[model samples]
Target: MKKIAIFENQYHQVKIQFEVANKIFFNDMLEYHQFNSSQDYTPISNISEFNLVIIDISLSSNSDKDGFDLIEEILIQNNPPKILILTGNSNIKENLKKRNLPDLPILMKPIDPIDIKDNLSKLLV
Candidate 1:
């Protein structure tokens, strides 16, 4: 079984993404962990435990704790999971570049279900 952790501030958006992930994989094969707005993304010690990580661009205050922060944090670990950046902002790549993160595949909001599936399939497979 593969673990997939998702960090999203909005409850409704997280709910929708979970449904999409569930549709893509069998329930037994994939375990999903969800973090709400207030929580930090640093708890999980072993990055290997999660095969994929989907992070929302605006988390909590939106001033701090954005998706780029989570990505930077994860990159410190040995073998970081494949990241799927879901952002409402169109300039997410620019924001990430400002933070000096690697060129990551970012999915813009409102995310298309097919695009999500297609991207995840490419990464996870």
Candidate 2:
């Protein structure tokens, strides 16, 4: 099974919804790991263990880094996993541009299960 890691701090409901939807649709093929902050995820020595990573732009104050920082760290790996951005921030495009990151797939806030599934399908392909 492929693994997916999620880094989300503020949107528990959205995360729960995605988990349910994933279980219903891709349970046999995908496994999900959720982290509430950078602190929770930073301990993992192998970021490439996951097939994909979903990140929320805004993180809790307790986190040592934000989503962008996490993305940069992941991208520097020899075999970086695919990334999907989930955010409410309107300036996400500008942020990516400012950081010189690629135009990754993005899911805006207030998304439904269908939206998540669609993006997952694309990323997992």
Candidate 3:
């Protein structure tokens, strides 16, 4: 079973992505995503246990750079899962450049399963 983590801020967006993932996946998968810190969407024992993490790089919480903060936190960990960023903002590439982080794989919003599938294939491969 592929363990996938989706770090997203919005409820409806997570629902949409989950639906898309479900279409391509079966019940054996263990999926997770970030929601309000108060609520646990999918209980994870360890962050590093995931096979892949799909992050939405939108402004969330109190920080304008919350997405980057999350990425940095994950990258700091030992053997972090494969990471992907999803964003509607085009300036995100420039933002990554300013921070000196590599241009990580990204998928724009209004995404189809094929787009997600393609990138996942490349990133996981």
Looking at candidate 1, the ten consecutive residues that score lowest on lDDT are 36-45
What is the descending lDDT order? 2, 1, 3
**In candidate 1, which residue ranges exceed 4 Å CA deviation?**
24-28, 37-42, 62-64
Steric clash pairs (candidate 3):
none
* Worst 10 contiguous positions by lDDT, candidate 3: 36-45
Please list the Cα RMSD from the true structure of every candidate, rounded to 1 decimal place.
2.7, 1.6, 3.6
User: lDDT for each of the candidates?
Assistant: 0.72, 0.85, 0.68
Cα-based lDDT at residue 58, candidate 2: 83
lDDT of 3 at 107: 86
Candidate 1 lDDT tens digits, 29-107:
6677777642444564576678998888777784356667667878888888998887788887788788898888877
Q: What are the models' TM-scores?
A: 0.81, 0.90, 0.77
